[model samples]
Target: MSASSSRPSYAAVLRLSHARRTFGAALLGRLSYGTVSLAMMLAVNRATGSYVVAGTVMALFGVMSVLLSPARAALVDRYGPRRALGPMAMSYASLLAVLAAVSWRPGAPVALVAGAAVAAGACTPPLGPTMRAVWGEVVRDKALLQRAYGLDGVAEEVLFVSGPLVVGGLLRFAPPAAGVALSAVLVASGTLAFVSSPVVRGVRPTPAVKSARRPRGGRALLQPVVVAGGVGLSLGAVDLLVVAFAEQRHHGDDVVAWVLAALSAGSALGGLLNGAFEWRTNARVRLPLLAAGLGLALAAAGLAPGLLALTVAVACAGLFVAPALTTAYLIADESAPPGFRTQAGAWVNTAVNAGGSAGAATVGLLVTHAPLGLCFALAGTVALLAAAVPAGSRMPTPTTA
Candidate 1:
């Protein structure tokens, strides 16, 4: 047979199509989630005149989402993405609308705020799991799968960086209420789009074999999968330190926004590079080195002076961010039992979010009583320590079929 004839033909084209659709769905979901998140934070802060309260609300949202994520993922696994998206979107919109209404009313009860926070948290759409499951189904090639994940990671960074800016602009130039309303509309529309896509619609839940029963909590949190969760916690600490450091330097409250954007832009660049490179090293080796590099770069940022210096340092720190994240995803995918993949992913995400909250709260206290630079130094030091932990240990092999 001719070499050309031996190569796969239409199958390659079909895979590309599926990848494109998956990317689109991810993009829309992220954009919607980011926008609403930004708007909600801004609105809550404005209404309450207390960032502490706003932070509490945000934390509650994260906590609830984390706690319920597995359940949400289970819903998707059982009924598919189409059925899950509709209720999630509607619930999300309704909750936001109620929040807006309560905020507008004079002397709104604290209960209203608490209720809003819980509702918002509970209704987070199963975007991450759904997209991940789709990728698992559609992309058969390992390299292509990695590239797709890199792209998704980059997209997430972009959404977080840009989404807030958009909300801020709307709230500043237009009306705050308008921003909230816009967020609701975007989220609902995006959810609808994701559900309606043929690729998403066609994804049926795989039959669970007897061996793949639901895992007990302790067992699930053990294993290399949990180690990956630790890595996420380390990253979260790094992020918190970056923000606290920026705030301490009198870079303004929005300094976090700028630094985040710079870091995200670097991560996006890293993702693209990850796609282009054909690395010969195993993930275990590459991931630790990458994480260590990130730690060193973050340390440099802690020692740097001024916004420009900090920005450069942040960007450099971000160079390894996406690679480390991709590595975590790969590990989680490999280590998780078949039926528990969604829960595994959720646990990773929850650990990251929880770690971030802890880091931020801790750093905030340190900065309040101690020097700002000290807070940055501590954060950088912790990150470096975290990076070293994985490096010193024997790396696990990537599991395969």
Candidate 2:
């Protein structure tokens, strides 16, 4: 047996030196991402009194954030997280604060709000990528690292689900801008604690010569990126399709929420299970299989007889979501050259977001004209096609650092 006699638990992963403090602080900072989207959109809509303006501003914000992520992560790879992440977080938080102030009341200048959003988005810290890289440094054991990534994925799923609920609760007592203000504080304080951790302090910048020697091309990333993008596209279509399904069947809007909750529940469970055991096959082979399973499940969802069956099918599709993403991150990390891991992870992150955005837009158009079942099939087919990307034979074995 290659691994230790004792299987590494999630508890064991956290038990690694400095893992708890570092991971907790990183989650604290990442929570800002989950909150800021809903908060800012509400703020912009209220201040401008136009969904058009709000949507456009958010589009700019999201596009800048997603497109520039790899560039930001590359900075971290070059200068290390401590040196690179601090300034980015501070600038991002400051911009959020400015946007909050500008949006505190109705009739704020539209140009000023849009400018602030673009700047804030561009400066958004690559916290997720940075923290994943830190996990690489803190836990050298391969099995433990797998658990760490699983735990991280599950926690992130929870944060995203809860963050919007928190904002919804807050809207009862405070203005939407208050949520934005809170997001600013969260990122600022969390980043401070994160950079101060002992383990993070030890992750020094890669030497210039070593960085120069690593391959800069995208060949190693082809498999994971394509699968991740496909997964994103499929999931993105699910949200709108579910809504259309509900409305067509005379179900209320709240049904959408319940169904989506089931999906999240399935994903959380799958992530936990994915980490609990070691697999004989490495991530390269597992990646496409997980993606294909998702595609099949989603396509079957279109054939569901009623809301109950659709919910079940969607939940089944969600089972593959977290593990597929976790596996993609693993492949991205393993395939990355020395000093390039952060950028590699960021590329995968970027693909997911970009694909999701495209999927939502494309589905939005198609849902209006086509049969709901056909639209669902089209989305699932995207993932199926991506799964066909060949996993080359000469893949690296998963190894401890």
Indicate which candidate wins on lDDT.
2
Model 2 per-residue lDDT tens digits across residues 100-177: 999999999999999999999999999998898888766667888889889989998999898899889889999999
Q: What's the distance in Å from true for residue 20, model 1?
A: 3.2
Provide the RMSD of all predictions against the true structure, rounded to 1 decimal: 5.2, 3.7
Residue 62, model 1, lDDT: 76
Q: Which pairs of residues clash in candidate 2, taking residues 3 or more apart in a chain or in different chains?
A: none
* Candidate 2 deviant stretches above 4 angstroms: 1-7, 208-218, 393-401
Against the true structure, what is each candidate's TM-score? 0.82, 0.95
State the displacement of the C-alpha of residue 289, model 1, in Å, after optimal TM-score superposition.
2.4
How well does model 2 score by local distance difference test? 0.87
**What local lDDT score does residue 42 receive in model 1, on the 0 to 100 scale?**
66
lDDT of each: 0.64, 0.87
Q: In candidate 2, where is summed lDDT lowest over 10 consecutive residues? A: 392-401
- Candidate 2 at 188: error in angstroms? 1.0
Instruction: Please state the error at residue 9 of candidate 1 in Å.
Output: 16
